[model samples]
Target chain A: MAVTDEAIEKIKGMIVSGALRPGDRLPKESELASELGLSRNSLREAVRALSLIRILDVRQGDGTYVTSLDPQLLLEAMSFVVDFHRDDTVLEFLAVRRILEPAATAMAASRISEQQIDALSAQLDKLGDSPSVEELVACDLDFHRGIVQSSGNSVLCSLLDGLSGPTTRARIWRGLTQEDAVSRTLHEHRAILAALRDRDGEAARSWATVHIASVEQWLRSTL
Target chain B: MAVTDEAIEKIKGMIVSGALRPGDRLPKESELASELGLSRNSLREAVRALSLIRILDVRQGDGTYVTSLDPQLLLEAMSFVVDFHRDDTVLEFLAVRRILEPAATAMAASRISEQQIDALSAQLDKLGDSPSVEELVACDLDFHRGIVQSSGNSVLCSLLDGLSGPTTRARIWRGLTQEDAVSRTLHEHRAILAALRDRDGEAARSWATVHIASVEQWLRSTL
Candidate 1:
């Protein structure tokens, strides 16, 4: 194996074998490179690879440390991949989100606290009938994100959050805004929240299905 | 921005903007570094990061290049993340798979070629009642992957395949080897294939549900 790859695997093995827990500090670059029998340059390559996957947090001037290794953290690398998705696949990606998010929201319905629902409701209120597409997009992202996180599956929540990335949505909403989109989006959001507020998983599923399908249809037409 | 991250984004932009395509060789490290106004060391760091996620192929002695950028290629990183899923969440992953794979199979039924089906059958024949755990696992992986790929949606097929990685099955099948597992798994494959042959999407979904759920049940029991 190449020295750089050997270094990557050795570090992965340390984590896998429980010798290096999340949040643990890595040895300084020079010392660790010598231990792994690799040049410092090669060892730095391994660290860079891990950091991209959110396995390591390399602070400037500060020492490098293992990240929390949370599912959300690891899957964040997915957004970069998703960004490069073939243009035609955005709808297919949305189809996936439609399946996952509804199921997730249904899961959230049973567990979302009263206060959490209030917070979600407040999120919708924070947006206006006339915010720019950008603010609306950000508001929309966080509102749904709050509900998904309420489901308490960090993996599901993060995957949903990452897939609902800005670049994809900015394009979608840019088109939607031209079609009397604002009220329509807000209306769907209200319906979704109402279903959840009633603690109705089935209703939430139905509403989310319609809600997601509307945007999906819009995206499909644009495509 | 850090020189390394700047390089990462610059390379990604090249792909996104059509300056780079799958299989396109990157500029020589020295050349790229000079162009991007970064040190060679920093550019190497950027290449290393992209390579880990299968975004770049860096063969020894050969120059680094953009990968095929296929969804399957991209989601392979998810396999490593699957390794670290919290114990019970494995079931959640399975639940998501149960949703994805059957839909994938239904899609495949329409698009799958005669030769592919013949090959699938041929693969099934290889897995007799007495195959080793490793062979059965390999067969199982190939069988499902074939169906997913047949869907012709690269993103969906690859993402589902990434979720249904071999390590998880090897871990489960190692334990489920009791109770005629070899035959049972093969039989399930036959049933699913039959549904595909009949072009019965509902039946295909049903068969896969039972097929995967049986494994899920066994896994749950083991857990």
Candidate 2:
């Protein structure tokens, strides 16, 4: 494991130092091993591990290459690990989302097109007053995602995407057991939508903070 | 690779569904492979990959087990991936930090201990007026990290830590070549420290935004 880790660092160092670049094919396994002063097996293990994380691409007979290293591809590993987090970890993710979502909302306020705002409104309309836990959870995810995507920062979008996964289950659990979960969430979404429609960044930010905080507050009291 | 990915998902599904939990030992290799309906070889590959990301722990002779799934541990994978990001990706990270650091500084303002504020003051003092590029870079990281840590959210701290890595290099480059880099950053740190000392979340937040924005602005113009 240590040898493989070292090899991984060497390969990553090459990327950081601009010796290897995105989409560049790596040298043959044997040659890279010698260049990095590692045994071929360790190098192969390192490559495999990195490939698993979407950092490297192993195309079978075509040879290994550096991935595009796009924020979406690299942060995919985060979504995987997020699934493993216990319920307790949700609070930490929420703390982060509280800071990010409101800021993202503010950015979106000025940038979101009329079409997008209409789509958001249409989305809320699709969720009637009394939706099931599953339906509510799906709508909730889409609503928050729509606003964050409008922020125009892919990294923020990806980070929030990863953070939102475990909480979606929590939201479902809340929707099933908590009183007025459906109506309360829908109401908050309506408030946030109005702010966005007004192109009021401050109001949008405030509404978003209030919206997510309501969920956090509920989680706190219930937990 | 596809088979290994499937095996990875199966193992992750177990964790997510609470069939397997943090620090839980797996059944012996053969039994676990059978349980997941995976070949032993594929299971081993999956485990190796997970271990690389700190999601699983592989003991030399002891059996493999799920790791604690701590935020710090899981997010370590992020730092590794962040290293592979292209120069343009730094902008995305900066955008995130711009949102997060201000919020984090605000949280820190009310919560930061007097001792911590003093420590930040001392940190700034150590940089002096004309520190070297390397010194300025290191101080710059520690200064921001100190405020974020005071926010008391490990996830936010880790995310910011990972985002700061490549930008540290950029800072060093700028410090070496740009005019008055050292004095400007030091002056900003002093302003943030003063706000933190006053327990003024709004001021702390504003100062943090200005401090980070200066760097972002520099990167925008230069990059």
Candidate 3:
């Protein structure tokens, strides 16, 4: 392994073995370098790399410490990575989303609070008929995010969030080019919200599936 | 933004905007640094960070280049992030897997070939009645991975692979401590394979679900 890789693995060993618990401040650079038998530069590079992935936090004047290592935080790295995906793979990403979002919606059906349902309904109402493409996109993201959050699985929520990046442009393009796309989206969102209000998991799941499937079908045809 | 973050974002913008296409060599460090108005150190750190996430590939004695940005390669970073997960969150990870693997399995039923089914069956048979815990874990991973790969969604396959890291130890623990767990797992694998052989997507999905739900049930009780 390269010197920096060795430095990274050593630090990862510390974290994984529980010697360096989350939020634990690291030893001084000089001390850690000597202890791990790595040069200071290699150690610093490793720290920077880990911090990029949110595995560590480097405060401006404070010591480097491990973050909470929450699935939400760790999987946030995925969204960053997803942003770099080439356009050809958007459908693959969407296929994964189609599987996940419906399950999340169904899970939310059982667990989503009445207040949360009302909140979602209110947000949908707030978007008047015939909103701009940008407004629709933002509301679409928020609406699904709200429902997924109710699934009570942080990992699921984070994965869906990460997977959404590559497909966002597809959505925007669909809205812009496909006449009646906006109305279809609005109608589907209302149907989903109604299903949730009725606590119908199967109906909610089916709605979420068709909602994403329509986007996938359109993108596939265009591609 | 931190200097390195600014540097990272500048590089990211180039790729996202299509100026830095995949496999394109980065400009010479000094020239690019000057062009971005970044010091060499910040640029170097940003490059290192991006490389760590598989966004950029640093070749020995060669130039840095943007990676293919393939979903598989990009999401490999998730498996690394998952390694740092605290034990308390393993269940959340498993829940996400439960949602995904069954769906992937169902997709596989329609697409999986006779040869693939034979190979899966052969592998399972090779692990005789008295397999070790390590063998069971390896086979279990290979089994689900084989099915998910047949699902033909690289993002789904990669996400499931990344999410599996946390629950691996849990699987091993259940195998070692829980009576009949190994036999039960083997039986479930057979059922899943049989369903796949019959090309029954719903049956495959249910078997996959119950298989994971059993592990989840066991882990929940222990936790």
Q: Alpha carbon lDDT of residue A203, candidate 2?
A: 97
**lDDT (tens digit, per residue) of candidate 2 on A1-223:** 3777788888888887898888999999999999888888667767878888888989887899999888988887787777777768778888899999999999999999999999989999987666676777778788888988999999999888888874555553563555576577778899988999999999989988988888788788776
* Per-model tally of clashing residue pairs: 0, 0, 0
lDDT of 1 by residue, A151-173 (tens): 77777787888788777877788
Residues B1-223, model 3: lDDT tens digits: 8877888999999998899998999998888899889878778888889999999999978888999888888888888888888778888988988989999999999999999999999999999777676777788889988999999999899888988864555454654555488789889999999999999999999999999999899888877
Q: What TM-score number comes out for model 1?
A: 0.92
C-alpha DockQ of every model: 0.57, 0.63, 0.80
- lDDT minimum window of 10 residues, candidate 3 chain B: B166-175
Using TM-score as the yardstick, the better of models 1 and 2 is 1
Q: lDDT scores for all predictions?
A: 0.83, 0.82, 0.87
Q: What is the C-alpha RMSD of each candidate to the true structure, in Å?
A: 2.3, 3.0, 2.0
Q: Please, what are the lDDT tens digits per residue for candidate 1 over residues B164-211? A: 777677777888767566577778899988888887877887888888
Clashing residue pairs in candidate 2 (N, C-alpha, C atoms within 3 angstroms): none
Residue lDDT tens for model 2, B1-223: 3777888888888887888888999887788888878777667768878988898898877898999888878887787777777777788888898989999999999889999999879877776566667777777778888888889998888888887874555543563465566567678899999999999999999999998888888778878
Q: Give chain B TM-scores in order.
A: 0.90, 0.87, 0.94
Candidate 2 residue runs with Cα over 4 Å from true position? A17-21, A24-44, A59-65, A166-179, B17-21, B24-41, B59-65, B166-176
Judge candidate 2 against the unseen true structure and give its global Cα lDDT, from 0 to 1. Answer: 0.82
Worst 10 residues of 1 chain B by lDDT: B80-89
